[model samples]
Structures are given as structure tokens and as C-alpha cells.
Target: MAPLMLFVVSMAQFIDIMNGSSMTVALVDISKALGFDSYSTQWIISAYVVTFGGFLLLSGRIGDMYGHRKVFLLGQIWFGLWSLVISFSTTPAMFCITRALQGIGASMSVPTALGLITTTFPAGPKRTRALSVFGGFGAAGAVVGLLLAGAFISSVGWEWIFRFSSIFSFLLFVVGYVAIPVIPAKAVTQKIDVAGAMTATSSMICIIYYISTGSASGWASVQTLPVLIAGLVLLAAFFWIETRLVKNPIMPFRIWRLRNFSSAFVAILFLQGQFQGFTYFTTLIFQNVMGYTSMQTALAFLAHSLFAVVTFTILGKVLPKYRLKPFILTGFGFRCVAALMFAFVQKSTSYWTLPFLGLLVHVIGLGTSVLPAQITALKDAQNEDQGVVGALYSTGMQLGAPLGLVIVTLISENSVDVKMGETPVEEVMKSYRNGLFGVVALGVLGAVITAFMMPNTVPAPPAAASAPTTAPVENSTDVATVATVGAAAAVVDLELDEALAEAAEKMEMV
Candidate 1:
């Protein structure tokens, strides 16, 4: 019951993460409706990611100091209020500010939700299942966000994305109030690391803003160079401060010493960059070059979500019984292949040949990599450390997408004009493909890093004869026997529970 409760709460957080990307589908609409030029329009996307990534560590630490549930609710309340502001936005500046606020809300929700899951669920089959569902739904919502955005953009208007998100926020607030239990009281004793938090946040904002704006102003221009330099310098200062001064830093310097953990974090960064690149490039190709309608573009991505869910379900069920390393390897290998294949996709190609096949393979490969990696990344981490673990992993994801977007935008802009019809579709797509190839190269590098760094075996079982372990082992064995003997009784009890949970999720999804 407790694990199930945590799983649902995490899913709500996934929905918030998904909402951040809905604007991609509405980018064209937003450009037209808000009268944004090419340069300003990108901010409509970049600002959200920048704020989300910037404050993530602080939000996680805040949740660690205060209660996770309290922080989560606070984020929802702020997000719901700002989402309404987004819906009513009449100018690009207004939209950007609101989106930035939405990003803050998201940062609060996502890491805290994962912290809740890690703290609440004991490591075992039950937790594994819940995590599989968590990873699965997050991937699914990203795909669904595009579809929903397309549908809303065309059927009603682009503003509906914000409207729907606002409504969803309200609903989640209500549901969380009734369904989610508070985190155990002892977990909230850590003090907030104010200097580390502020330095990190400000430094990250400076860097991300520099990169996001660099395309409009040349990288060498005065406007871009100062911000980039300041950001780099301040970020260095952040690390120095964290290591030397802070008693409890938001990102503890010690965790990076574990090769597997650092490797896993890098892997997530590369994979997420690859994922966002694929989705962004493909969607642009379909809509901008191929002249596909919003509905068509949205529907095109349906296969990605479906294939990811299917692969996740199969992989999740089997990984528990075997060493996790082989699955992780296979997933990365598949991901590299899929990403490389996607890099070769052409604007003139048939939808059935490269695009569909590439997306399917990528989705399946991503599914295999993510769930196991997420588990391995935080394996055996104490409850006190879960906030850092979640923050670290999710920071990889949030930072990766914007970084990828910045890279792709620079590549595509330098080589081809997507906004200009004078540029050939093939040439534009070629530039996009060039950017994707770089992302794929990063994935291949991540795979190699993971191969060497991640432990190559299952976790070792506790010693059976240890004096401290004896009583817990005996009780656990007894519990296992009782569970097996009472399997028939538990099966009936669990069936109703599953049905109810599904119904609840469906209601929330609506």
C-alpha cells in the first residue's frame, strides 16, 4: 500500500515534467500568437529549462530540510497560479516569465517525488515495479505531451496547454492532499545550504542563458562572452565553496568519487540529450519541412510512447532476477545504434523507412537503459542521501535537454536557415542531422563510460551468520514463507487494489 501510494505521487511529478515540453508542439502557434520573432521565440522554450535546471539542487535541498510533501504541495500551488498567468500571457516577455515560474514549480516537484519514492519503498521487487512504472510514465508523458499539445494547439489554441496544466495542477493538489502520506518525520532534519544553493543557482542561470542566447548574438560577441565567462567563474566558485565552506552542501563533493554514480549521471545526461534531440529534430522535420498538420505530427509520436512502455514492462520484470550490467550494456548498445540511424534520416525519406523505425528502436533502447540505470544510480543510498541522488540524476536530464537544444540550434542556424524558405529542406535537415550525430557520439561515449564504471554484477547478499543480521534474516525468511503460503489470499486482496489504482491514474490523466 505504501509503495503504491509513492508510485502515484511520483507519476504526478512526471506529469509536471511532461508539461515543460508541451510548448514544443505549440512553438509555431506561440510565435504567431505572441508576435515573437525567431530569436525571441526560442526563449519561450529555453527560459523554462533554464529556471528548472537552475533551481533543481536548491529545491531538492529544501525538500531535504523541510518535508518532501510540503515542498511538493508548495510547488504545485505556485505552478498552478503561474500556469494561469501563462494562459493569459499577451506578450513574449509575459509568457517567458510565467514559464520560468512554471520551471521553478517543476524543480520542486520532480526531485522531491523521487526522494519520496526512494524513502518510502524498500528495495525489492515492489520498489522495482514501482520505479519501472515511474520511468515508464515519465517517458510516456513526454510523448503524450507532444500529442496533447498538438491537439490543444489546433483544436482550441496554444493557450490551452497552460490552461490544462493549471487545471491539472489544481487536481493534483487535491489528490495529493487526500492520498499521499507525509514522509517519516525524522527525514527532514538537514539544514539548507544557502551559499551553495545561491551560487549554484546563479551560476547555472548565467551559463544556460549565455548558451541559449548565443545563437542570436555570435558566440564571440560582447553580449555572449561576458555572461559565459562570469558563469564559468562563478560555477568554479560554487564547487570551491561547496567543498570548503558548507557543512551540508546541496551537491556533496564526496558522491562524485564513486565511479559508477558519476558514470550513471553522465549516461543520463547523454541519453536525455539524445532523446530530446531526436524528438525536437523529427518534430520540426515533419511539421516544418514535410508540411504535416499538428494532429499528424502529434499522432506520429504515438508509436514512440507505446514501444517504450512495452519495452519497459518486459525489461523491468526480468532485470530483477539477473545481473543488471548486461541489460544496461544492451540498452546502451541499442541506443547508440538507434541514435546513429536517426542521424541519417532525410526530409525526403518515407515515414515508414527511417523515421518510424528509428523512433521505435530509440524508444525501446531508452526504456531498457533508464529504469535499470535509475535503480543502479541510487542503489543502497541512505534515506538522507536520496535527495542528492534524485537531484543529481534529474539535473543530468534537465541540463542535457537545454544543452542539446543550444547545440542543435547553433548547428542548424549556422549551416541552414529553418525560418527561411530559400534554404532547401534537405540542407536544413542535413544540419539537424549533423547535430544529432554529435549527440549520438556522446551516447557512444556514455556507453563506454558505463561499461567500465558500473559494477558488473548483482548486489551481494548479506552474510547469513552475522550476529546483527540473524534476527532480521529469520524474520524476513518467515515473512517470505507466510507470503508464499498466503499467496492466494494476497492475490485477491491485490486485484481490487490494482483496479482502484488504475482508475485513479486514469482520472488523473484525464
Candidate 2:
């Protein structure tokens, strides 16, 4: 039962990562089918990410307030339905709409899934192993998506990706209903913080939308600056409301006080941004510049993916007994090496020099950072807050991809345009160099954030044979609030259940 539940949780997480990577391969084909230019088609990818990242906090909070199982199932059903819509989308606008819906579903599902894993296992070796497998599967899914996308696009059609995801999502939904244990609410009737949720969601949407459209529409265009300004303003407003307005704000400012958690979040943001940015541009370099086929590109990524899985598995077994900070530090060092190699990649550089060696260094770095960071955050989060905190961690990751894409694309777009003249290979390489430099700068900043902010040794969750463990919670005040909310929520749930039962009886009579 424990293993089955773990698989269900990991599978849901896999779907989220797979959706992003798979869609990336299908981007070219989808553009041709939907009659979109390069600029317009980018939205199909960006829109999903924007919505997914924006809603993560709210979705995770919902799981914390209500029940992880309830929210997870709801997210799955909605995602499956939206996937069906996407498979048959006739226009870019329709595709974008359904894509956003799919993001919403993913947002709902991911945090709750992570929370469920944490809730089901105590914060010792069991939880550590589970999280390791979870992280490994996530990396593995991206690799699988790349391979599957290539094969499906070549043999079947781009539409099959959507169809496959839709089927897989539904099957998971069904499996979840049967297997996932219902986690009782840790808090009573928690009043929904409608105002805070709306403000944060709207702010994120506006900021991301502005970034997504700004380059194509002209950064100075009438629509861009105002939207960007508004988003920042609203985000500021959200911070204020969370701090002052709500009794139980969605993302309590208190969580940030933990030096380890706060630093991890920041480093991951930069780390994820670079990670996502690398995949996008590298794929372009291989397929567009070097004229490598999708299958070849997918094959290239496999080595990195395999290495990541191996590292995660090893980390899972060892982290429970050892300190994680050193591993994190070492990880960042590897990332720096990888970023430098990629930054100076020559147009004529063979696979052995730039692509293969650079990626090997990168994957090693990525595994080191992620395994330690995820363990650090969840290991300390209170039992109740695990769902939302897990969600926030993932939001940092998902946000990085689109945010990185927008930033790097803006920087590199001007240099890579085709014209009526002879553009040298060196010029193409120059644009890539610019993007890689951006990645390297971010990586250096990430290393600094991790080294200074994270502690030398964080207290681990008490092992079975060691001292008695208190529930992992950095903030006592937040824990008190979660309890109060959980208490209030039970009454409302009973009332809701009764009302639904009555309504069902009435419908049967009719």
C-alpha cells in the first residue's frame, strides 16, 4: 500500500514534467498545424507555464486547508478534460485557452501530490527515499518526453502527444481514486483567503503575460510597459495583504524567515531559470542551427537525464545520514563549470568538446542542487504546511523555465534573425554566446545565494533510533493558524457532504 501510494504521487509529478518537455518537441509541428508564426507559437508553451506557476501557491494552500486527496483528484479530472480539448484544438487561440486550463489542473495536482508524499511518510529515511525517487522520476520524465515526442512526431503525429497525455492523465486519476489514502485535514474550517489568492494570481498572470508578449509586440509598445508595471504593483499589494490584511494569508510571510528555506527558494529560482533556459536554446541550437533531427537531439539529452537519476538515487540513500549543505555547495560548483563550457561553445565544436562534456557537468550540478534543496525544505516544514511548501518549491522551478525563456529569448532574438544577406556561423554563435553568458551570470548568483544563505548544517528530522522528533515546523504562529483553520473546516465539510447527498436524492426522484 505504501509503495503503491508513492508510485501514484510520483506518477502525477511525472505527468507535470512530461507535459512541458513533450510539448517542447511538438512546438514546431503544432505551429505548422495552427498557422502561427514563431513569435505567436511561443505562447502555446509560455501560457501553460504562466498559469501553472501563478496558481501553484493557491493550489497548494487549498490542499493544506482541505485535503490533499480531494484537491489532487480535482486537478487530475480537470487536466484530463483539458487535454482532450487540446488534442483537437483547431486554432492557436483555442490551443492557448486549453493549454492554460491544463496548467490550472497541473497547478492543482503538483503541490498536493508532494504534500501527500510528505504526509504519508515521517521525515526520516522513508520520506527522504520517497522524495529522492520523486525527484529522479521528474528528471527521468523530461528525458522520456523528449524521446517520446521525437518518435510520436515522426511516426504518429504531434497531436498524439496530447492524446497520449490525456489518456495517461485519466488513467492516473482513476488509479488515484482507488489507491491514494485520504489525508484528514490538519486544520479546522480555514476560511478561504479570496482577496489574497486573487491578488497574487492576477499579479503573476499580468507579469508573465507582459513578458511573453513584450518582445514580439515591441518592449516600448503601448500594451507592454503598463501591464508590467501593474503586475509589479499588484505583487507589492499581495505582499502587503499577506503581511497585514488576512487573518490566514495564502503565503504567510513567516515562512521566509527560515534562512535555509528562503535561500533555497532564491537559489532554485535562479537555478531553474538557467536550467530551463539551457534546454530551450540548446534544443534550438541543435535543431535549427546544426540541423540535427528531433531524435538526435533527444538522444543527446539522455546521458544527462540518466546521470541525474543515478545521482538522485545515491543521494536519497545517503542524505539521511549525512549533511546536505556540502552536497549543495559542490552541485553549484559543477553548474558553474557547465555554464562556462556552454557559454563559449564554438559553431564548429564537436559533440565531445561542448555538447557532451558541458551537459555532463550540468546534469551533475542540477542533481546535487535539487536533491539537497528539496530535502532541506520539506524536512523542516510542519506536517500541515508540507503540501503548500512543496507546491511553492515546484512553483519556483516551473516559473524559472518560462521566465528564463522570456529573458534569454529577448536577449538573443535580435542577433538570430534571418535576412536577405549572408549571415556567418560566427554571428549565430555570438547570439548563443550572449544567452550562455546570461545563464552563467545567473548561475554565479545562485551559487552565492546558496553558500551564504544556507546553513553549514541543518538539523535533520529525528531518525527512528535517535531522539524523539517533533513535527517539522519552523513557524509556531503559522502552525497555530493551520490548526484553527483545520478545526473550522471539518464542520463545513460535513455540511457540504450532507447537502450534496440531499441533492443527489432529489435528482434521483426527478
Top TM-score model: 2
- lDDT computed for candidate 2: 0.79
Instruction: Estimate the TM-score of every prediction.
Output: 0.85, 0.87
Please write out the lDDT profile of model 1 over residues 72-114, one tens digit for every residue: 8788888888988999999989989888988898888888777
Query: What lDDT score goes with residue 356 in model 2?
Result: 90
What TM-score should be assigned to candidate 1?
0.85
Top of the candidates by lDDT: 2
Model 1: how far residue 120 lies from native, Å: 1.1
The local distance difference test score of each candidate is 0.75, 0.79
RMSD of each: 11.2, 11.9
